[model samples]
Target: MLYGAQYYRPPFPGRACWRRDLAHMKELGFNCVKHWAVWNWIEREPGCFDFSELDELVALSREYGLQVVINTVPEGAPYWTYEGNEEDLYRTADGQRVAYGGPANLPSGGWPGLCMDKPEFAALVAAFIEETARHFADEPAVIAIDVWNEPHLEPMYDYRSNMLCYCRHSRAAFRAWLKGKYPSLDALNRAWYRTYSSWEQVEPPPRFGTWADMLDWRRFWLDNLAGWLKLRAGAARRGAPGKVVQTHVAYSGILGNRIVGGLGNELGDEFLLAREVDWFGLSSFPKWLMGPDHAYRHLIHNEMVAEAAHGKLFYQVELQGGAGKPGLLGGEVPDAGDVKIWNWNTISAGGKGTVYWQYAPEPAGVESPGFGLTGFAGEDTPRSLAASECAGRLNLPELDAAVRVPAENAVYASRSSDLLTFASERREEMYAGSLSGVFRAAYERGIPVRFLHEDYIGELAEATVRFLYLPLPLVLSERETEHLVRFVERGGTLVSEACPGLYRPDGLLDQEGTALGRLFGLGHREIQGLPDWGMVTACCEDGTVFAGKWYRQLVNPGQDVRVLARFEDGEAAVTERLLGKGRAVWIGTYPSYYHEHGFELDGGGKRDGTRDLLTRFMSLGGYGIIEKVEVPECESSGISLAPVVRLHRLEGEYLLTVVNHLEREARVKVWFREEQAFAGGPGKCLELTVPARDGTCARWSSSRR
Candidate 1:
């Protein structure tokens, strides 16, 4: 695994530190550095390509034994390339074209505008790529090409202009896309619920509206961006054949917002984009959003990128490296603890490498004061030293020796979920709240859980997925529903919450009632809100009780289904059903809300119970004999918070990592299944007393002595 920071050339005032920066990062255990090939800077004039600066950087990095990842910024073309082609400037919904660094002396002597889907603009991009490839192809230090950066048009935060790049060029491209999808105008009209007589009449929606059209518009750009990436990757491969080519995703489903024009920070379907590139990385800054909730959401983001890689481990790019500038997008500097946990959280989620955003603060820029590994004076800042020390510990041989396996608990995420989740920002309120509460609950209980997008659902059997948890899947297709049923029927445990499979894959309401009733053997009736901050109460026959500020629901359970609990009004609150050799559990109310918001909303008991519920749901898988973990001595030890423990199966061995977030030392024990002792003669009662706010990771094999 690689551990390092992004190395940007220093501004002119401190240009001398460029070489020093590479040297500093090298000594800090960084193996790689990425340089943004700002197209405008590389090609100052039309057809006159200059490789001087790029060539120097590559050669210099090679001297430091640092691998280089070059970003081909076709998304930011030089002004000269747009000469006599200013009409190609990306046009927004309101006909406002983003004009930054215009005419004469370009802003900072660079332009950041290009219509990615345009043929003429694409040719220029190809030329730049080919030239870059020819120049750096033979450079041993240049190891990868970042095929594109951010992959969206400019005026990113200008919400006033509406969603992005609705220029005639993109609209024509989208029309062509519709032609390919619908084949005829009549079919297109039927799908979009429109009366268009020809494909030419179709256009990207003016604004976010109607799931049918919004789906089409989003799908178009998602595919468009991916298609454009494929071309760019091909160009990079042609330019530097066999070099590792990768790209990155920016949108955090929970933390990120839709860019202007409804084209989000990520494509509608990230897997599609991943399919077009060699590998995928994501931008993660826990500070960008707040709370430990961001930590779990960040985990999901990392998992999405990992899934997109199709077995290739993912990376985290642009990690928080400095204190954010004080403003809307900035925040206070992250502490060593936050940085350490952030890195581990992503890695534990299966990231192969991580690159901090920068090695030093910029001498000048919009974000100059915000992000840095060191201060502007080039002195090692507290954060940089902490990052370097952290890097030294991670760039180890053992990391390479271990192979990451899927966790026991897997959450299902699909494109339908994303489409519905991102449809309206308001609709997304439930998404993070639900998943975070569940993830946090599982974390506290030490149940190894991870997110698996629908694309990887077929691998459930091979991954040894014992339990499957779906948190509010609002949409599902027939195929997806069938897959879920088969999974449950094949002896896999299942758990889901409200609105699971209630909507069709196409974003329409599934009016036929229960689309997934056959598996869970249940269907939801009307969901009635409790008036006057009403607290929904649930009591299980097993003597467990939970109450929350949540919605009340009525449910219909089948013959084999057993109602475990009900609302105060006598509606089904939770139910369990047997399917084949397996069982599925359905949670009726928004319990996670009770878990996360309870502390503030006067539902602490519900919050604590939710954690037990996550563990109980998995225990319902009906294992006659199973593994168990116990905190044997915590009360006297002053360890208040439960430790989070996870096991990663590897080739002929497994790695168990435990993070103790508590303030006091605590002894914990793990009893293996089948009374098996730990490998090499360790007893069946595997016990350890972890230090406060510390972590313990050990490699183990199942081969007992």
Candidate 2:
């Protein structure tokens, strides 16, 4: 449970108060501090390395007994690297070259960085990281070295364009990647629908044309970014053997980069990137990025990253310290209450380390006068004091054993489905919304849900997930299809929305041939796409009527399939099938999408029965709410439709974290099952009063103990 804030990066927070700031941070209960090792700032003159300022910073950190994480910023490469290497600069799909200089945050210049596809420039970047790691390898205070910062392609803060690295070097690297993937020129030709005579004739698609080519292009970038991270991490490991190697993404691809034609095209896959590093995490500027709804998105974002880490050590690498916006238009400044809620949310999601973006306000550059825990004069604020209290609680010896992520219900996240949705419709809002809506429905009901990646489906036998949800699953691979059948056969319940496996992994339509037909006992012959905001009503067999938005799947069910619901046209809208010892339930329309829209119009006050519908299906899987929070239904602007309560199963005790989203104090009645009762306790319920817009954590011994 390492707690700290980012402290240095070349020329910020002036050197005059370095000693004082370090001592102050220690007094505030920060056990760790992070510093940037900018490539351009250190290697100003070609190969000659200078570590005077950074060395002093590390020494001061050591003096204050703070562990250090050396963050290497290759994006701020030396001016010399691109002076004679103009060809290595980033280029867009339209053949436009981006100039090299400092990005918004890095005032020292040298931005958009050099292209790693170019071998010569790549070596230089690797050399700088290796050198930086070796420089502080001997220091006991330097506990870890982060190879990359907010890993992404293209320029920072520039989401306007998705096309990146279309230079000659990048094209050559793409060809090499294709060659390795396809095995030969003929296979490449078949996949891309091209008739190339040789590998040299193959070129990365300049524009989106065919689905196969575009998906391959996107997949190539995902792998390429992982390869780039591998290079950086390898260099650091060579320089420092025992030190932890870590890298964090700007955001999870699932939540932030779901747009196929936009940010998704330019960002690295978290799953792939996590495998290349020792520890994986993400930067969360919720206050700056998400306003009143920051807590919900922040918690979900951390959960996604934790899933990406696959049980490995993950963190909130850059929690918002203060104001997040740039320059004169300062972003929302978080208060002491905000700090407590945000910090607890991170810890509840199994974040082992929490570090703010900075310790003091930016002294210069575009981000000046913002993003700091302390004032300009190095004085602590209420937010900083609240952070100290969180640190104290996190460092408790009981915490390591108390806070654990034990989720038995999960929603499926498919990289293939996301890409296919984007390629076919040119927008990812449908898929992204579905995932969000379904997760939100479960979350609001106090269900302990986490995301499950498609690639890890093979681990289902060993997984604890009882209820698996498939949201907007338009495409699924044959491998996934096989495992899903096995999963249902083994007494696991699966609930899926419309159009599951509408497209195969090879970008071919196969509704009848896939496991979807076998498991669900149904297939749709046609899908009628509706206009925006169009509503389609369905009546369930139980006399419950619910509405769905977007398209509707006209189901043609086979024998032995029970029709759970029907559309207005009397077509099967939802069906359930008994497969082996378990069941497969399918909704013929996007109910989750409709449920999401519910939150938008009236803060989820409108009950369309979708929440009850989804939760009822989950009950069949034995994954209902175990520890329920009893609270009145209140309308809210964001995802915090109700009080958020998370129960973690500890060694002998159950640790519960409750977050109140309302403006007024809440007297929450938390009810647990008889098996989950506390040892020698009065009853199955406990009454606790929580302050408005805040949270609290409590623990009790399990009756079994």
Give the winner by TM-score.
Answer: 2
Number of clashing pairs per prediction, in order? 5, 4
Worst 10 residues of 1 by lDDT: 632-641
User: Which digits, one per residue and each the tens of the lDDT, describe model 1 over residues 22-91?
Assistant: 7888887788888767677667788777777767777888899888888776555676766676677777
Residue pairs of candidate 1 with colliding backbone atoms:
162-261, 163-260, 163-261, 164-261, 325-370
RMSD of each: 4.1, 2.6
lDDT of candidate 2 over 211-233, digit per residue (tens): 88777777788888889999999
Scored against the true structure, residue 67 in model 1 reaches a CA lDDT of 87
Q: Judged by lDDT against the true structure, how good is candidate 2?
A: 0.78
Score candidate 2 by TM-score against the native. Answer: 0.94
What is the TM-score of each predicted model, taking all chains together? Answer: 0.89, 0.94
Instruction: Give the number of the best model, judged by lDDT.
Output: 2
Worst 10 residues of 2 by lDDT: 257-266
